[model samples]
Target: MAERSFHVARLPGFATMAVAVFVALYLPIFTLVAYSFNASNSMAVWGGFSLDWYAKAWANEQVKDATVRSLVIACFAAVISTAVATMAALGTTRRRAFKGQTFIYVMINQPLMVPEIVTAVALMILFGLVKTVTGIHGLGYLVLAHAAFCVPFAYLPIRARLEGMDLTLETAAADLYATPWATFRRVTLPLLAPGMVAGAMLAFVISLDDVVITEFVKSGGQDTLPTYMLGQLRRQLTPEINAVSTMLLAVTVVLLTTFFLLTRKKD
Candidate 1:
């Protein structure tokens, strides 16, 4: 009875703590989403409900250009990262643990573990040197930075799937006198498709949201959407920014929904 009463006494505190956590995490998001619809220019005071800001933001040439640039960068990064990650997963899973395996893993995931500023500083210095030597003022530097950073995000799911997959199917294909490439293409590739798609999506989202590395690696006059948003924020706060944010949120939701629908189990 004493133990039961003690447990009952703690329940309210646990409930309070959970409520606090939920409020802390979601209250700001709720506010931002709500204010997106405010008719007034001031975020602090709501004048009315209006969609004019959305129209203005959509019509902005600079916003359109930034959005297109961001999409192109994300697509390229996703493709490159997914391809390299798939190859790395196959090699790592097929081979026995080696002296360099851990090192390679660390290097691949360094972008995630290291501070953003550190990566930005290193990339800036490296690119500056490359620019001095090569004189190529291209956005390829940004593409490389995004792809390199996205690799670990693409690597993890593919590696997990490869590790968990049964090897018997590949063995049977080999026993049937199939070439190694044929075996992989017919058996392994089909099995790995879902994980590869998931990893690619992950890489794409990471590249899309990235700002720090982009700021460092991007040449002058080549700003992605996030960088453009940052610039706008620095100058002034406007409902147009909020409208842009809402559109970005909608795009993300649509992409994630599409990914889910594509990956869902079929009867």
Candidate 2:
């Protein structure tokens, strides 16, 4: 009975801790979202509610351009990174271990192990050389940089799915004279789709929010949404920033909710 009372006494502490954690994580988000409708420019005063900030954010040419650039970069990064990482996952997990296989795996996943700033600096130096050699300046450099960062993110879950998969069915298919390409196309690919989708979404989010590499590799006039937000911060804190932040938060919420629903285990 004494021990039971002690446990009961601790329950409130645990509950309080959990609530504290949730509040700590979400209170800032809630404040940002709430401030999006603030009539006043200053965040301190409520100044009643208004949607003018949303309108202003929408009408802002710089915001529109940056948002579009971010979307394009994320889309390209997601598709290309997913494709390459899926292939790498399949090859690494499905094949028998051979000489230098470990090295290949390490090399493929080096981006995750290295610091982002280091990667950004390396890409800056490399692309500088390329630009000097070819004289072409475009968004391709940003796309490639983002893709390099996203590869390890995409590789992890796909490789796990591949490794956890049962090989007996694949062996049976082989025994029945199924071609390697056909067996993979019909069986392995279908099973691996969930992991691939999850990884791609992760890559998209990473690319969307990346400011460091984008700041480093991007040339003049190519501001992504995050970089645009940084630029705005330098000028002043306005409801416009809040409104844009709210939109980004909504997008993140939608993506995560959709991903959860899509990837949830079916009955």
Task: State the displacement of the C-alpha of residue 7, model 1, in Å, after optimal TM-score superposition.
Answer: 10
Per residue, candidate 2 scores C-alpha lDDT tens digits across 82-145 of 9999999988888788899989999999988889899899999999999999999999999999
Model 2, CA-based lDDT: 0.89
Worst 10 residues of 2 by lDDT: 3-12
Report every candidate's CA lDDT: 0.87, 0.89
Off by over 4 Å in 2: 1-12, 98-103, 262-267
> In candidate 2, residue 85 scores what lDDT?
98
Candidate 1 residue pairs in backbone clash: none
Q: Count the backbone clashes (under 3 Å) in each candidate.
A: 0, 0
